[model samples]
Target: MTDEMNNAQEWQARAESAEAALSRVQAEVDARLIRAELKAEALRAGMVDLDGLKLLDTEDLRLTEAGDVADAPALLARLKRAKPWLFGVAMSSSSAANPPRPEPPRTRHANDLSHEEWLAARAVLLRRR
Candidate 1:
């Protein structure tokens, strides 16, 4: 009876430890998933810096059954409104609203010169000196 009791207690302790470890792993995984979701949402919203995520209050955020942040878009929108400096200018879907600027023709520079061109220029410069 004594041996049986000791064996049962030992098994219980092992089971408890296993449960604790499993909970820790689950918490870590959930944290990682939440971070990933927030990052994706932030990128989509044109967040200039990822560090802006640290400013967010995650206490109110809930996780969906799919393991995604439920109020992620809303949370990001609030953050963007609160701290507009953290995000870049929002891109418009229609190019008609803002047309692309035309670029002027690029002038040739010393860096653009080939070996032969460089030698000729060097010769001309040396003669002028």
Candidate 2:
């Protein structure tokens, strides 16, 4: 009877320890899943950088049994709304209010320059040298 009692207690201790370890591992895995979900949603929302995720409040975030975040997309959307600079610039359907300025004209090369123009340019360049 004494031996049996001791054996039962030993088994109980071992089981408790195993349960504790399992819980720790499970929590770690859930945290990783949450992070992955957040990243996926942030990417879909056009986050400029993953670092911006750190700014989000994750205390309200919860994981579903399937390892998916319950409101990751919504959370990301809220974050985007609060911090527009954290995401990629949104394109407009209409053209820019100010049209792009035309590129400056190309510089005329010596070979393309008229004889008189070349002579004038040559004198200027020579003076600079």
**What's each prediction's TM-score?**
0.70, 0.70
Point out where model 2 deviates above 4 Å. 96-129
lDDT of 1 by residue, 1-129 (tens): 999999999999999999999999988888888999999999999999999999987766767998889989989999999999999986768757666689988887999999999999999999999
* RMSD (CA, angstroms), candidate 2: 6.3
Q: Which pairs clash in model 1?
A: none
Tens-place lDDT per residue, model 2, 66-125, is 878997888888888899999999878895588768999878778898999999998999
List all candidate RMSDs to the true structure: 6.7, 6.3
Model 2: pairs clashing at backbone N, Cα or C within 3 Å: none
